[model samples]
Structures are given as structure tokens and as C-alpha cells.
Target: MTPAARLSAAIEILADLSARRRPAADALKDWGLSHRFAGSGDRAAIAGILYDTLRRRASAAHVMGSEEPRALVLGMLALMRGLSVDAIAALADGGRFAPAPLSEAERARLADSSLEGAAPFVRGDYPQWLHASLRHVFGDSVVEEGAALAARAPLDLRINTLKGEPEAVKAELSHLHPEPCRFSPLALRIKLDSEGKAPPVSAEPAFLRGEVEVQDEGSQLAAILARPVPGGQVLDLCAGAGGKTLEFAALMDNKGQIYAHDSDIRRLKPMHERLARAGVRNVQVRSPRGAEDVLHDLEGKMDLVLVDAPCTGTGTWRRNPDAKWRVRPGALAQRTAEQAKILEQAAHYVRPGGRLAYVTCSLLDEENGAQVRALLNKREDFSPVSPTENVLALGASGPALAEAALTSREGLLMSPRRTGTDGFFVSVMKRAG
Candidate 1:
């Protein structure tokens, strides 16, 4: 497929996305199926255009002076990809599946605009409603933060201790070099100079060996905040895909029982094979069980309960750019309710004085700070603890964790802008005896 055709495909997908509420991935898949003649590179190019357009829809549209898919694609090509008008014109010839020549208006907009400095549209690619929340969380580095969110994220892998230590995995996958991330010891950063390719994640031998599992650095920290000790009764109440559960079991040296339960067993199905392949034996999958029944037997018995609650996933925009487009202000109320319910349900399993770690991959206050506050207000038996402080008290090698942990008066909120990880919120609440 020619560059013009890929642009045309992106425009079609974007138009479909704007007209209806189809998921970007689904829309891309459907488009791919219909255009089977397009090669893998063509599909990836089209998908890239679609996600880039979505990430900066408002800014790209504003800069390009139109919301049309053609204009947006042209704008993305010029502004985001740094492609010149001549380049775009050259690639987008009127070929099969290719879009027609750019209209005079489209070419004019692409030629006239500039994204040189920090503009409002560039500052916050998210919806207007999210501006204040983003500001509150990101404060001074909003531009850098927003840029990170707007950019495509690289694939991250967590060396599965259940399979091998980080050093061992690093040795085995030395071809990838798998640099040790400054934040999470378990995390290995995949550095890419340019965004041409996603750096062969699934094809890597380390992935096939199950030595490393794909996970964000922020998610790894959240699991670490839970501080799963060896031989502890850990309950992952919202164990979707068992990533954290598997991580927790590794922390426990696979000695203690990890009751990995979720309301949706369908999501947990894939974990069965992943767990076996990773050689995780300590985790016991509890599926198709009602939340009430699961908690009834484990009440006040679990040493740690992790609530990796559901949220708007604003922090994960780099990976799932479409989520920003899908989030609505009204949906947040429903999400808040669900988060509260999950917290209350999971809190029951926390042993007396044990920690209930609440986590979310979100930068929103409603999901992070406010959720911790709400839980503290409603539950008298639980008092919130600072995970940053706990980690600091233990002492780390890089820097004093306590300095940041002690300074922040509110709950723990880790932003990708600051930590080079996904946006994550983690707070420890200890049950009062």
C-alpha cells in the first residue's frame, strides 16, 4: 500500500470512530480484514496514523483547521511525523485504496500551521473536562506529561522471578540489552530512537521463554507497594489476567497461597496457560465465584488484599490512545461507584492490621487521591498508610524514596512524567485491630 492509501485508510477509520462508538482496535481490525491485500507494514502505518490522530485530535484538528479525516491525517503527518507537504503529496497519490489528492484547503492548512511551542491544544490533548484534573496531578510538567501521553509507548517487560531472576533473564536476553529501569527493579525498558517500529516484543526469545511478561513500570510498583512477603496469604481481588498475582506469588517465592479471584472469569481464562508456562504454582485461581462468596470465607484472614481497580485508564494513553476518546464525564460517576464497591468488597479480606493496597492506572484524582480518601472516611477500621514512606523506610539505592514520599501530603500518585512509568496510584490502608 502506498503512503496515500495508508492515510486514506486512517481517515476512513477515524471517520468511522467519530461517527459511531466502535473501538479503535476493532475498527482497525475490521478495516484490516476488509483490506486483506494491505501488508503488515501498511496495517501498522494505518493504525499508527489512527492512534496519533486520536491522541491529539483536538490539537491536530485545531492546527489543521478541520475535523475531516483527510485533513487530520495530513496534519498528523506534517506535525507529528514531521513529514513535509511534498512527502505526503508524493505518498498519497490516487492509487487503489489510496485517498485522492489533498484538497487546496487541506494543503493550505497543513502548509500554514506550526507546532513550535507549548500551545493549549498541545498542552492538553485530552478532553477539556480532563484539563483541571491533569493539571492537579501533573502541576508543572503538564506539557511533558501530555506529550508522553500523546506519544506511542514502548513495550515493557517484567522479568518473571518465578521463572528467573532479573539478572538471569537479562543474561539470556542480552541481545535486547534489557536495561534496568530506575524505578522498578523488575522492569526492563525498551528504548527506541524513532517510532518506525515497536521493537519486536512478541518475537523476542525472552518473551517466548516466559522470562519476561509485558507490564508497565507503574503496575510493577503498585504490586511492590503491596509488599507481598514470603509465605503470606495474599488475595488479588481484582486479578485480571493474574499479572500482579503472578508477580506477588514470585515475591512470596511461590510458598504462600495467592487466591487470584475476579468477577469476570472470562478475563482470567488466559492466565491459566500463562501461569503454567511461568511455573507459578502458589497462585490458586478462583473463578466463576460471586464476590460475596469469595470474601465470605477469606474475611479478616488475608495478609494482603490488592485492589487493582478499574478506572478510565487515562495514564495508559500512550499504549491505548483510544481510551482518551472513549472516556466521558458521565462514565466517571459509574466508574467511581464501581471502584468504591470493589474497595469495600476487597477490604473485607484484609486480616486485622494487614494492608489493603488500592491501585489504579489513572492520573485522575477521583480514581487515585479521592478514592483513598473516600475509603478512609467510610471505613473506620482502616487507616491509610503511605507506600512511598514504607519503601523509603526500607531504603533504596538510587535515591531516598522518603524525601518525595514524606513531602507529598496527599496520597501516593506516580505519574509517568515524573517516574518514566505509567500513571499509577497506590495507597496502603491498614485494618485497625
Candidate 2:
């Protein structure tokens, strides 16, 4: 596909996103199905352009003085990707299957437009409503944090230490072995070149043998922050597909038990196969059975409860850029409320002196710091614990690194900027006796 054709595809997808309430991915998939002539390169290029435009839509609109897809594509090219107007015009010039030529007005607009005072647009491309919340969480470094959110992310894989160690997996895939991830012991960070394509890990022998799982370094770190102890009873509430549950079992050396429960039984069904493939034996998949089925016997008996609660997933905008465009304040508030309920329910399963870790892949404070604060405020029997200390105490890492990574207080909040991993908030709480 020509560059202009990619822009056209993005425009069509953006229209679908704006008209209906569908995700960009779904729309792009539908487009791909209808336009079967597009090859893999064409599909990827179009998808990349669409996502990049979504990531900076607000800012692009500000510069172009229009929110139309064509204007957005042009603005994004000029401002975000630094494509010159002449270059874009050349791409849109008389060519087969190319987009319509750039209008005279568009050329003038591109030349004269400046985004000097558009603080929200230039800083992070976020809506104005999010400024206060973002500032509340990031303080003075909100701009840098927003910039990170706008950028692309690399593919990260977590070595399934249950079947094989990281070193063994690396040795097996020696040719394709990625750089060691700084934030996660199990992660291998695969950096893509300017072409923006990650190598196919599924085709790798290590992946086929269940030696590694393609998970973000941030996600691997979030699971690690839970600090599962060997032979300790653990509960992964909201364990969708059991990706982290597999990690939990590995952490436990397949000893003791991990009760993996989710409201949706259909979601946990696939995990049975995944666990088998990974040689995970310690997990017992439990369907909610209308909340009481899994809740009755597990009350106040767990040593560790991991609440990988649902949220807006703002931290993952780099990978799922279209998500930023779909997020609304009301939806975020609803998610926050649900996260609180999940936390409260999961907290009930943690016995006195047991630990409960609340986690989310969101950059929002309401889902992270604020949720922990609310839980602490509402529950008399729960108190904040040091996450770094808990992990170190579990023998997760050496004392020197633990001391460097953790605060004098216990809660561990990892920013993508700080950790070079996913934006994750992990708050460890102790159920007071």
C-alpha cells in the first residue's frame, strides 16, 4: 500500500471509531476482512498509522484546526512523526490508489499552524479533563510521563521458569535472545528497528516448548510484586486466562495451592490447557458460581491474595494506543468503583497476618494510590505494608537491590519512566489481627 492509502485506511478506521463505539482494532480487522487485497505489510503499516494517530489525536486536531480523519493524518505526519508538508503532499499526489491530493487550504493550514499554547495537546495529547488527575499523580513530571504514554512499547517476554530457567530459555533461543529486561528477572525486552516489527516469538522453539510466555515486562514485574511464597496458599482473584496464575504456580514451585477464580468461567476454561502446557500443577481453577461458590471455603485462609484489578489501562497506551481515545471520565469512575469492590472482596480472603496485594496497569491514581488509600480508610483490619520489604523477605531479590528499589515505607509504585517497565501500582497490605 502507498503511504496515502495507509492514511486512507486510518481515516476509515477513525470514522468507524468515532461513529460507532467500536475499538480501533475491531474496526481495523473488519476493514482487513473487506479489503483482502492488503498484504501483511500493508495491514501493519495501516494499523501503525491508525494507532499513532489515535495516540495523538487531540494534539493533531489542535494543529490542523480540524478533527476530520484526513486532517488528523496530515497533522500527525507533520507534528508527531515530523513529516514535512511537502513530503505528505508528494505522498498524496497523483498516484494509483493514493489519497486525494492535499487541498490548498490544507497546505496553508499545515504551514501556518502552531501548537504553542495548546499545553494539553503538545504535552501529552490527552483531553483537557484529564489534566488535573494526571497532574495529581505525576506532579511536576506529567509532561514527560504523557510523552512516554504517547510513545511505542517493545515486545517483552516472560520466561516460564516452571518448565525452564531464563538462562536455559535464552540458550535455546540463543540467536533470537533479546536484551535482559531491567525491571523483571523473567523478561526479555525485544527492541524493534525503525520498521516497527517485533520478531515472531511464537515460532521460536522456547515459546513452543512453553519455556516463555509473551508478556510485558511490566506485567511480569506486577506478578513478581505479589511475591508468591513456596508452599503458601495463594488466591488470584480475577485471574482471567491465568497468565499470572501460571507465574504464581512457578513461583511456588508447583507446591501448595493457588485458587484461580474469575467471575467469568469461560475465561478461566482456556487456562486449564495453558496450565497443562506450562506444567503447572498447583492451581485449582474455580468458577465464581454466582460469587458464593468460590468465596465460601476460601475466607480468611490465604497466605497471599493477588488482586490484579481492572482499570482504564492508561499505562498500556503505548501498546493499545486506541484505548486512550475510547476512555471517558464516567467509564474510568465505574472501573475505579469496580476495582474497590474487588479489593474489598479479595481482602476478605486474606487471613489475619496474611498479605493482600492490589495491582493495576493504570497510571491513574484512582486505580492505584487512591484505591489503596480508600481501602485503608474503609477497612479497620487492613494496614499498609512495604511491598519491597515483602518481596525481599520472600527472598525475591538481594537486600541491596531491595533497599535501592523500595522506600522507607512499604508501598511500591513503579512508573514506566522510573522502572523502564509498564506503569504499575502495587500496594501490599497486611490483614491486621
Candidate 3:
């Protein structure tokens, strides 16, 4: 398909997503199923256009003076893709299977528009309702942080040290030009093509050998900060698919017991296969039958309990741009409540003098600092631990990682602008002995 046709397809997908209030992936998949003639490359290009448009939706609308789907695509091309007026015009020319030509108003909107004068939220391309939440965490850095969050994210892989060294895995996957991440000693970053596709890591021998897993650099940091002690007890309280659960296994040298459990059993089902492939044996999958499951014996015995809690995922907007627009005001309340509940429930399992690490892939303070503060208020036995200790305890990656992340009162708030990672808030609190 021609690039013009791809843009048209993207516009159609965007319209459907907006009208039906569905996820971009669902809308894009439906488009693909019905339009079987579109090859993989065409579908990828269309999907890329859709996501890029969503990434800068508000800013692009402001630049085009309209919030219509086509206007967004045109503005995105001009502002983001570096396409000139004439270049976009040639594509939007009334050729067969091409988008309609830019209207006179669109041409003018694109002619001399600048985002500098737009509202801060509009300039940041995030939901206007989230301005206060973002400001609470980022303060003066909100716009800069939001812009960075709106940018595309590179693919990150965590080298499973239980299977092989990062050096060995890096050599095996060198064709993808993987580079060591600045913040994670075990992580490698891979840049995707313009169509926004990573190499089929799942099909690679290295992945099949359980050498590297697709995890974000920030997530790697979260797992690393947990610093689970070898021959100690650790519980991944919400280990969906066992990403961090697997990391904990390696971090503990597979000598300690790691229990992987989630509130939803369906999400935990896949961890068995993943754990098997990763050559992990020390981790146990707990399939709970009811609200009260098999974790009773673990109470007051666990050395560390990590809560990778449920969140609004504002931190991962770079990869899932549609999510930023879809997040509702009610979701903040719902997610915060859930996070608090999970943190409270998980805290009980932490032994005295042990750690309860709370983590979220969210930038909102309500789900992060506020929740931790509430917990600290309710549980006088627990006190927040400084992440500086974790940073200082690192062997070689300490200085680089220490410089990469920011120190937030909640814990370490790692943002794309500050840490060159996805948005993540990590707070480790200790239960008194």
C-alpha cells in the first residue's frame, strides 16, 4: 500500500477508536482482519501512523486548529515526521485509495501554526484532566516530562542471568544492535524501525534458550532495586506472567523461594510455561481459589514482599499512547484504591525487619506517594527506606543508575526525561523488627 493509503487507513482506525471508545489495538486488529489485502508492512505502517497521531494528539490538534482525525494525521506529519506542506499535500492528493486533499482551512492551520502558545496540557499532548496529577509529581518539569513520555519508546530486554551472561546474550542478539541500558546492568535496548516493529525476539534462539526477556528498562530497575537476598524468602505479590518473579529468581541466584501470585488467576496461568522456559525452578505459582488462598503460612515469614501493584499505566504512555487519552477521572480513584488495598494486604506477609517494596508503572502521585503515605500513617511499624542504599550497594551499575533516576519522597520516580526510562514509582518500606 502507498504511504498515503496507509495514512488513510490510520485515520479510519482512529475514528473507530474514538467513536466506539475502544482500545487502539482492538480497532487496529479489526481493520486488519477485514482488510486482508493489506500486507504486514502496510498494517505496521498504518498502526505506526495511528499510534504516532495518538502520541501527539492534543498538540497536533492545536497545530492544525482542529481535532478531527485527518487534521491530526496531517499535523503529526508536519510537526513530528518533519514533512513539509507540499509533501503531505502530495499524499493527500485525491489519488485512488488515497486520503482526501487537505482542505483550505487545514492548509492554513498547518501553514504558520506553533504549539508554543497552546495550553500546557495541549502542548504536552496529555489529557487536560491529568495536568494537576502530573504537576504534583513533575512540578516545573511536567511539560518536559510529558513531551518525553509522548515520544516513542525503544524495546528493552532483560538478560536472564540464570540462563546466560548479558555479554553472551548480547553477542547472540547482536544483529538487532542491542545496547546496554544506562540504568540496568542486565538490560539491553533495541531501537525499532520506522514501522515500529521489534525483531521477533520470541522466535530467536537466545529467547528460546531463556537468555533474554522483553522487559522495560524501568521495570528492570524496579526488580533490581528489590535486591532480594539469596537464600531468603521473597514473594512477588502481584506477579502477572512472572516478569519480576523471574528477575527475583536470578537476583536470588535461584536459591531462595519465590512465590508468584496474582489476584486474577488467569494472568498467573502463563507464568508456569514462562518459568519453565527460563529454566527457573525456585519460583512457585499460587493459584488462589478464593479471596483467602494459600498464603496464610507465609504471613510474618517473608523476607521481602514486592507489590507490582495495579495502576493507570500513565508511565508507559510512550508505548501505548491511546491509554493516556482513555484514562478517565474515575480510574484514578479506582486504581489508587486498588493499589492501597494490595499494598496493605501484601504488607502483612513481610517479616519484621524485612522490606515491602511498592511499585507502579504510573506517574500519578495519588497512586504513588499518597498511597505510600497513607500506608505509613496506618502502619506505624513500617518506615520508608532510602533508595540511595540500593544504588550504593550496586557493584558496577551504581554510579550510572544513581545518576539516571530521580529521588522522589515516595521513593525513586523514574521518568523518561529524567531517567531515559518509562515512568515508574518505586517505594521500599521496611517493617520494624
Candidate 4:
């Protein structure tokens, strides 16, 4: 498909998403199924345009003076993709299967568009209602921080040390050209194309042979900071899909007992194959019989309990822009409630003097620092663990990493602006013996 046709496809998909309140991925897949003539490149291009529009939706609307799908696409092209006005006009020209040429009003607005004087939320490309929450979390740097979260993320893969070292995996997958991640020893990143697509690693020999798995660098850091000792008793209290569960396995060098449990069995269903693929033998999957019935035998016996709690996923906007728009205030309330329950429950399993690490892919304070504060307030036995110390204890360059990240009350919040990765918060609390 020509660039013009791809832009038209993106506008249509965005309209469909708005009308149905559907996810970007779902809309894109449906479009692909219906437009079978579109090749992989065409689909990729359309998806890139759509996600770019979503990522910069608010700012685009501000620039274009319109929030319609076409306006958003045009704004994205002009600003997000850095397309010149003439270039965008040629693509939006009234050619066959192309969107109508840019309207005079759109052209006028684009010609004079400026985000410098716009509202902070508009400049940040996030929803206006989230301004207060974002500011409360980021203080005066909210726009800078949110803009980074609005940008596209590179593809990151974690080498499965349970199977092989990073060098062996890097050598095995030389064709894809993976680079070592800046902050994680086990991570490799594949740079995204201009259209934000990475070389497909699913078919690579290393992945097929249990040497690597796709993971965000920030997530890799979170799992790394959990500080589970090798040969120690570890409970992955919310081990959905076992991404970090597998990481814990590698961290322990496959010598420790890692019990992976989740309240929802559906999420745990995929772990069996993934664990087997990563050659992680130390993990035992505990599928809950009820909402929170798993891990009965492990109470008061765990050396480390990892709670990768659920949240509104505001931190992952770079990857799931639609979610940031779709999320509601009520959803945040629901998540905080769930987090409180899970933290209290998971605390029971931490042995005396053992540590319970709380993790969330959320930048919201209510879901992160506030939750830790509540835990500390309720139970005087648990105290905040120094996130800087955790980073330092994990490696030789702990000071550098701690410097690169934000030190929260009891943890660290890693963001794309600071860490060149997705937003992740991790807090480790030690129990009194």
C-alpha cells in the first residue's frame, strides 16, 4: 500500500476504535483480517500510524484544533512523524482510496500549531483529567516525564541464563543484531524501525532453543531488584504469565524453590509452556482453586515474596496508549483496593526477617508508594527497604542505576525518560524476625 492509503487506513481504524471503544490491537487485527491484500509492511505502517496517533492524541488534537480521527492522523504526521506540511498534503491528497486533502482549516492550524503554550496535559499527550495525578507523582517535571512515556519503546529481550549466558544467545542471534541493555546484565534490545517494528525474534534459533524471551528493560530491572537469594525460598505471589517468575528462576541459577501462583488461573495457563521453554525447572505453578486460595502450604515460610500487583497500567502508555485513554478514576480505586488485599495476603507468607517485594507497572502514587505506606502503617513489623541499596547490592554499578532512577519512599520508579524503558515501580520491605 502507498503511504497515502496507509494513512487512510489508520484514520478508519481510529474511527472504529472510537465508535466501539475497542483496543488498538483488536481494531488493527480486524482490519488485517478484512483487508487481506495488505502485506506485512502495509499492516505495520498502518499500525505505526494508529499507535502514533494514539500516543500523541491529546497534543495532536491541540495542534489540529480538532479531535476527529483525520485531524489526529494529520496532527500525528506533522508532529509525531515529523512530516512536512507539503508531505502530509500529498499523502492526504484526494487520490483513490486516500483521505481527502487537508482542509483549509486543518492546514491553517497545522501551519500555526504550537504546543509551547498549550496546557500541560495537552503538551504531555496524556488525558487532561490525569494532570493532577501526573503532577502529584512527577512534581514540576510531569510534562517531560509524560512525553517520554508517550514515545515509542524499543524491543527488549532477557537472556535466559538458566539455559545459556548473554554472550551465547547474542552470538546465536547475531542476525537480529541485539545490543546489551544499559541497566540490565541479562537484557538485550533490538532497535525499532521508523515504523516502530522490531525484527521478529519469535522465529530465531535462540528463542526456539530456550535462550531468550521478550521483556521490557524496566521490567528486567524490577525482577532483578527483588533480591531473592540463590537456593532461598521464593514465592511469586502474583506470577501472571511467569515473566518475572522465570527471571527469578534464572536469578536463583535454577537452584532455589520458586512457587509461582496467581489468583486467575487463565493467566497462569501460559506459564507452563513458557517455563518449560525457558528450561526453568525450579518453579512450581500454583493455580488458584478460588479467587485467592493458592499458596496455602507456603505461609510464614518464604524467604522472599514478590507481589507484582495489578494496576491501571498508566505506566505502560508507551506500549498501550489506548489504555491510558480508556482507564477511569473508578478503575484506579478498584486497583488500589485489590493491591491492598494482595499485599496483606502476601505478607502472611514472608518468614520472620524475610523480605516482601511489592511491584507494579504503574506510576500512580495510590498504587505504588501509597500502598507501601499503608502496609507499613498497618503492620509495624515491616520496614522500607532502601531501593538504592538494593540496586547497589545487585551489581558493581548500582550507584549509576540508582542515580538514573527515582528513589521513592520505599522503592524505585523507573521511567522511559530516566531509564529508556517502560515505567515500573518496585519496593522491597523486610519483615522483623
Candidate 5:
């Protein structure tokens, strides 16, 4: 299919999403199923256009002075892709299967539109409702920070040191041109293609052999911050699909006891296969059996307890832009409540002198520092570990990470603007022995 036809399909999918108030991925998938004649490249291109449009939705609407689907596609072309009036006009020329010819108003907006007096939410391409929360966290630079989140995220992989050394694994996947990440020594970054599609790393021999696992650099840093010692007892209280659980296994070289459990058993299903593939033996999967306490026996026995708590996912907008728009204030309230409850539950597993690490993919202060502060308030035994000390686990990268991150009295905040990573907040607390 031609580029124009792809743009038309993207516009249709966007309209569907707006009307149904559903995820863009679902709408795109349904569109693909119905339009079977479109080849793989065509579907990928359409999906790319759809996602780029979503990423720039607010800004595009601001620039075009319209929130309609066609206006968004045209504005996205001009703003995100930097297409000229003539360039965009060519794609909307009304030649069969193409979008209708651009109206004089659209052509004028495309030529003259700018974000010059736009509000922070408009300039940042994020939902307007989130402006206050983001401003509270980023201050005057919220626009810059939000714009960074609006950009595309690079694909990151963590080398499973238990399987192979970094250099050895790097050599095996050399065809993909992976580069070492700036902060995490275990991380390698892969740039998405020109069309914003990630290379099929899952098909690579190294990945298949469990030499590398797909993980964001910020997440790798979060796991590293836990600072679990080899032969220590650790509990991953909210180990959804066990991303950090696998990381903990590698960090301990499979020596320590690591019990991974989640409130929902369905979320833990993929972990068994992932653990086996990664050659991890330290982790024991504890699936919830009805209302029975799955981790009752292990309470108060852990050397480290990790709460990778659920949140609004504001930091992950670069990867899931659609979520930024879909998130609501009610949802934020629900997540914070859940996070508070989870933190209380996770604290029970941490023995005296052990550490509790709180993590979130959100950039909101309420879900991060505020939550940590509240936890410290409730538990007199737990005191926050200094950000300076937390970085010690990273070795040579420690100082660099310290300089790159936003450190608070309660914890460290990593964002795409500050740390060149997804937005993540991590705070470690030590329970007095």
C-alpha cells in the first residue's frame, strides 16, 4: 500500500479509538484483521503512523486547532515527521484510497501552525488533566520532561551474566549493532529502525539461548538498586512475569533463595518459562492458592524485599503513549491505594536489618516520594538509604548515575530527560535490626 493509503488507515483507527475510548493497539489489530490484503509492511507502517499520531495527539490538536482524526494525521506529519505543506499535500491528494485533498484551512494551518503560546500539556503532547501532577514533579521544566517522554524509546536488553559475559553476548548479537547503555553495565541499547520498528531480537540466537533479556535501562537500574547480596534471602513480592526476579537471580549468581510471588496467579504464568530459559535456579515460584497466604511461612525472613509496585505508568509513555491519554484521575487514586497496601504487605517479609526497595514506572510525586515518605512515617523501624549509598551497587557507573538522577530525601527519580531512560522512581529503606 502507498503511504497515503497507510495514513488513511491510521486516521480510521484513530477515530475508532476515540469513539470507543479503547486502546489503539486493539483498534489497529481489528483493522488489520478486516483488511487482510494489506501486507506485513503495510500493517507495520499503518501501526507506526497510528502510534506517532497518538504520541503527538495533544500537540497536533493544538497546532491544527482541531481534534479530528484527519487533522491529527496532518498535524503529526508536519510536527513529528517535519513534512512540508507540499509533502503532506502529496499524501492527501484524493487519488483513490488516499485521504481527501487537504482543505485550504488545513494547508494554511500546516504552513503557519506553531506551539508558541500553547499550554504545557499541549506543548508536551500529554493529557491536559495530568498537567498539575507533572508540573508538581518537574516544576517549570515539565514541558521539556513531558516532551522527552513523548519521544520514542530505544529497545534495551540486559545480558544475563550467569549465561555469558557482556562482550561474549555482544559479539553473538553483533548484527543488530547493540551499544552499551550509559548507566547500567549489564544493559545494551538497540535503536529502532527508521520506521520506528524494533529489530526481531527475539529471533536472535543469543536471545533464544537466554544470553540477553529485553528490559529497559531504568528497570535494570531499579533491580540493581535492590543491592541483593549473593546467598542472601530475597522476596519479590509483586513479581509480575518475574522481570526483576530474573535479574535478581543473575545478580546473586543463582546462589541465594529468591521467592517470587504475585497476588494474581495469571500474571505469574510466563515466569516459569522465563526462569527455565534464563537458567535461573534460585527463584521459587509461589502461586497464590485462593485466599490462603502464599508467602505466609516466609514472612519476616527476607534479607531484601522488592516491591515493584504498580502505578500510572507515566514514565513508560515513550513505549506506550496511548496509556498516557487513557489514564484517569480515578485510576491514579486506585493505583496509589494499591501501592500503599502492597508496601505494607511487602514490609512484613523484610527481616530486621534487611532492606525494602520501592519501585514505580510513574513520574508522579504522589506515587513515588510521597508514598515512601508515608511508609517511613508508618514504620518507625524503616529509614531511607541515601541515594549516594544506593549507587554503590553500580560501581564505576555509580557516580555518573548519581549525577544523572534526580535525588530526593526519600529516593531517586530517573526520567527520559534526566537519565535517558524510562521514568522510574526507586527508594530503598532499611529496617532497624
Candidate 6:
């Protein structure tokens, strides 16, 4: 397909997404199924255009003076891809299978449009409703932070020490030109292509042998901060898909007993295969059976309890830009309530003098520092570990990550702008002995 045809297809998908108010992946999938003649490259290109449009949706709309699908595609081509007005016009020249010719006004806007006087939300390419919450968190630099979140994310992989050494695995996957991440010693970063597509790392021999797992650097840091002891008792209370659960197993060198449980059993289905592939033998999956207290046997006996609570996923916008637009105030309220409840439940499993690590892929204070404070208010026996002590687990990388992190009274917050990572807040609390 010509670039113009791909742009037209992206516009069509965007219109469908806007009308249905659904996920971009679903919209893109339906488009592909219906247009089977389009080759893999065409589909990937269209999906890339669609995602880039979404990432800069607010700013693109403001620049083009219209929220129409075509306008967004044109504006994004100019703003994100650095296409000139003449360059964009050449693609939209009303040729067969191309977008209709650009109107005079579109030409003018594309030639002169700027975000100099645009609102903060427009400058940041985020929803206007989130401006206040983001402002509260980032203060004068919310626009910079949000713009960082709007950019494409690099693929991050954590080396599974249980199966392969980091240096050996890096050598095995050297074809991709992976680089070591700044913060996590076990992490390697793979840059997405110019079109914002990640390599199919799942097909690599190292990945197939469980030498690496696709995880965000921020997530790896969060797991490392948990500081699970080798041969210790640990519980991953909300171990969805067991990403961190697997990390914990490898960190302990398969010596500790790690119990992984989730409120929903369906989410645990993938972990069994993952654990097997990662050569993890220390984890025991506790599937919930009709609310019959799946984790009752281990309450108050854990040396470390990790609650990777659900949230609005504001920090993950670099990858899921559609979610930032779909998130609503009501959803935020629901997540905060759920986070508080989960934190309370997780605290019960932490043995006296043991630590509980609370983590969220959210930048909102309500889900982060506020939640930590609320937990402390309710549980007098639990006290927050200082940000200084939390970074100790990271060793040489600790001081740099500490300097990059935003320190709060209860925890540390990491964001794309500050830490070159997904938005994650982690607070470690110790239960009284």
C-alpha cells in the first residue's frame, strides 16, 4: 500500500474507534479482518499511524482546528512525523485510494499551526479532564511530563537469571542491538523502529528459552525495591499474570517459597506456563475457589507481601495512549477504593518486621502517596521505609535512581520525564514486630 492509502486506512480506523469508544487494538483488528488483502506491512503501518494519532490526539486536534479523522491524520503527519505542508498535500492529492485533497484551510493550518497559546492539555496531548490531577502531581512541569508520556516507549526485557546469565542472553539477542537499562542491572532496552513497532522478541531463541521476559524498567525497579530475601516466605497478593511473581522467583534463585494468588483466577492461568518456561520451581499458585479463602493458610506469615494494585495506568500512556483518553473520573474513584482495600488485605500477610511493597502504574497522588498515607493512618503497626533505604536494594544504580525519583513523604514516584521509565510509585512499609 502507498503511504497515502495507509493514512486513509488509519483515518477510517480512528473514526470507528471514536464512534464505538472502544480500544484501538480492537478497532485495528476488525479493520484487518475485513481488509484481508492488506499485507502485514500495511496493517502494521496503519496501526502505527493510528497509535501515533491517538498519542498526540489533543495537540493534533488543536493544531488542525478540527477533530475529524482526516484532520488528525494530517496534523499528526506534520507534528509527529515532521512532514511539511507540501509533503502532506502531496499524499492527500485526491488520487485513487488516497485521502481527499486538503482544503485551503487545512493547508493554511498545517503551514502555520503552533501550540504556543494552546491549553495545557492541548500542549501535553492528554485529556483536559486530567489537567488538574496532573497539575497537582507535576506542578509547573506537567506539560513536560505529559509530553514525555505521549512519546513512544522502548521495549524492556528482564533477564531470567534462573535460566540464563545476563551477559550470555544479551550476546544471544545481540542482533536486536539491545542496550542495558540505566536503573535495573538485569534489564536490557530495545528501541522500537522508526515507525514505532517493536521487534518480535518472542521469536528469539533466548526469549523462547525464558532467558528474558518483556517488562517495563519501572516494574523491574519496583520488584527490586521489594527486596525479597533468598529462602524467605513471600506472597504476591495481586499477582496478575505473575510478572513480578516470576521476577521474585528468579531473584530468590528458586530458593524461597513464593505463593502467588489473585482475586480472579482467570488472570493466573498464564502464570503456570510462564513459571514453567522460566524454570521457576519455587512458586505455588493459589487459585481462588468460590471465595473459600485461598490465601487463608498463609496470613500473617509472609516475609514480604507485594500488592501490585490496579490503577488508571496513567504512567503507561506511552504504550496505551488510548487508555488515557478512555479513563474517567468515576473509574479513578473505583480504582482508589480498590487499591485501599487490596493494600489492607495485603498487610495481613506481612509477618512482624517483614515488609509490604505497594506498587501502581499510576502518577496520581490519590492512588500513590495518598494511598500510602491512608494505609499508615489505618495500620499503626506499619511504618514507611524511607526513600533512601528503598534505593539500597539497587546497589550502584541506587544513587542515580534516587536522584531521578520524585520523593514523597511516603514513597518515591518515577515517571518518563524524571526517570526515563513508566510512571510507577513504590512505597515499602514494615510491619511492627
TM-score of each: 0.92, 0.92, 0.97, 0.98, 0.99, 0.99
lDDT of 6 by residue, 224-252 (tens): 99999899999999999999999999889
Instruction: Give the per-residue lDDT digits (tens) of candidate 2, residues 170-284.
Output: 8876777588877466778888756466777888877878898888876776777777889999999989998889888887899999999888788888898888879998998
**Residue-wise C-alpha lDDT for candidate 1, range 1-433, written one tens digit per residue:** 7666677888989999888887899999998899899999888878888888887776787778777777777777877788887887776777677778766777787786666664654656777778777877667767667877887776678888777777778887777656877667788887754544566777777777777888887788778877888888988888989889878877788898899888898989889988887788988888865545755788889999999998999889888888887889988888899999999888888988798988888888888788888888888999877555556423372244333321243356666556677777778888987
lDDT of residue 42 for candidate 2: 86
| lDDT of each residue in 7-61, candidate 5, tens digit only | 9999999999989999888998899899999998999899888888889999999
Error of 1 at 109 (Å): 2.1
Q: Is candidate 1 or candidate 6 better by TM-score?
A: 6
Please say which candidate is ahead in lDDT: 2 or 6: 6
Ranked by lDDT, the better of candidates 3 and 5 is 5
Report the error of model 4 at residue 384, Å.
1.0
Roughly what TM-score does model 1 have, to 2 decimal places? Answer: 0.92
lDDT of 4 by residue, 1-433 (tens): 9888998999999999999997899999999999999999999989999998999999999998888999998998888888888888888889998999888888888887679899999888888888898899899999999899889988999999888877877888887778888989888999888789878788887888889999999898888899888999999988999999999998899988999988888999889999889998888888887556667789999999999999988889999999999998889999999999999999999999999999999988889999999999999999998887789755875787899888966799988888888999999999999
Q: Model 2, 212: alpha-carbon shift in Å?
A: 0.7
Poorest stretch of ten by lDDT in candidate 1: 401-410
Best by lDDT: 6
TM-score-wise, the better of 2 and 6 is: 6
Clashing pairs in 3: none
Backbone clash pairs in model 5 (N, Cα, C under 3 Å; residues 3+ apart or in different chains), count = 0
The reply for model 5, stretches above 4 Å from the true place, is: none
Error of 6 at 281 (Å): 0.4
